[model samples]
Target: MARQLRERAEQHTETHLTLRDLRHVCWDPVPGAVVYVCENPRVVEAAADAGMDAGLVCTSGNATTVVHTLLTALVEGGTRLYVRGDFDWAGVAMVERLLTRYPAQPWRMSAADYEQQVERARDRRTPLQPLEGRPQTASWDPELAPSMNSFGMAVHEESALDLLVQDLRQRP
Candidate 1:
């Protein structure tokens, strides 16, 4: 299944795998493998559109059981996960959950990344939606939550597609 996903990725195609598909599949550990995981499908779409031959996964919001199953298999296979999501409170919470539950790293989801995206929006005269809901702390990066609080703006994943795509391009 992982090899099939890789083939689809090589062809720049989007492949969705379900829990049933993963139930009987055996995953061989891929040493030094890197996969980009995000909350939105747009990042995957953008990477595919750019013809990037990188392993990309999207949760399409809060991860479901299938997502967790896939991630667990990936982690067991020694794949390094780089995770990113919207800059809103819920997004932060989702990221925090993944970071804690899995061996994953933040991908362009630092205080600097949030600030950069906020600045870019300001520069383009684009008004970002004010953040709603209770604020969530970013345990992976201590300063990220404070920075987002300071701005009180939500930076959706769409706004950071360029940087995300660039990161995908630079994947080893």
Candidate 2:
């Protein structure tokens, strides 16, 4: 399923816009529309398999030119963007980027959400290193980055997939 979504996302990129050209386009979701964002291919695949009734796009780990282009277009189109990613540093970074680049709503990517998931973690002893690139503030939720830093561990979005899907289903 992941592969299929990846392929689709890639194909979408081939015909649409490359990541480099993202800055030139605008990606705004329609009012009340939901656009799912993720760092992993599997999540994209699952969403695709479930039938993406809403606007959906995959970042495929880090915002590539294609991901940026699609997201920008959605924002310009006035579509509401919902982003979810690994709970780790990279995830936070990705969320930060999305929030900064696009007017996106937080999709369970919060400190409270992280705390709940942390309580459910199987192994909590291993401390995660801070994400290396330029750290960007999470404009939507300021406390998120700090909370992750305090916890010193990474959380993958897959861990919270059920919560995200349930939330998406409830949205009209």
Candidate 3:
């Protein structure tokens, strides 16, 4: 299922994973290896297109049970998770939940990253909509939520796609 998802993105690739399929799939991650997690699959697709031989996973929003299963297996094998998501209330909630489950390192879900993307979105004239719903604290970056609320901006992963792809490109 993971390999199938890694192929070129198609319009109809939003299928859910079954526990049976999850049980059979195996990725014996190297000890102390790093795996990248993102909310949007586009980030994964972009990284793959950049020829990144990376351990990447896409949660496709709130993350499914299959994602949790995959993450658990990777952590048990000593793989560190580096996660990123949309810079919004929902994004923060998702990150907080993941942090509670595993000792995952945050990727671009930082106050600095949020601020920079907010500026970039402005420069690009992209609509900076006010963060909706209740704001949630970032378990990884303490200041991220306050800063995001103050700025009233949400930075989606696409804004930092190139930077993430660069990280993947430079991976040894």
TM-score of each: 0.93, 0.69, 0.86
Between prediction 1 and prediction 2, which has the larger TM-score? 1
Off by over 4 Å in 3: 1-18
Q: Least accurate stretch of 10 residues (summed lDDT) in model 3?
A: 6-15
> Evaluated with TM-score, which candidate comes out highest?
1
Residue 30 C-alpha lDDT in model 1: 88
Evaluate model 3: give its lDDT.
Answer: 0.81
User: Candidate 1, residues 13-132: lDDT per residue as tens digits?
Assistant: 998888888986767788779988999999889998998888888999999999999999889889999888899999999999999999899898899999999999899787799989
lDDT of 3 by residue, 1-172 (tens): 6577545333323345666777876665689998888899888778766667777788999988889988899899899998878998998899888888889878878899899989888898887677898989887778998898899877888878888899776754
Show pairs that collide, candidate 1. Answer: none
* Candidates 1 and 2, the one with greater lDDT: 1
Give the 10-residue window scoring lowest on summed lDDT in candidate 1. 1-10
Q: For model 2, how does the per-residue alpha-carbon lDDT over 1-172 read when each residue is reduced to its tens digit? A: 3344347655543123454545553333356566777677666555545554444566778987677767666666767788878877667777777777777776787789887777656454434444454344666678877777677667676665666656656765
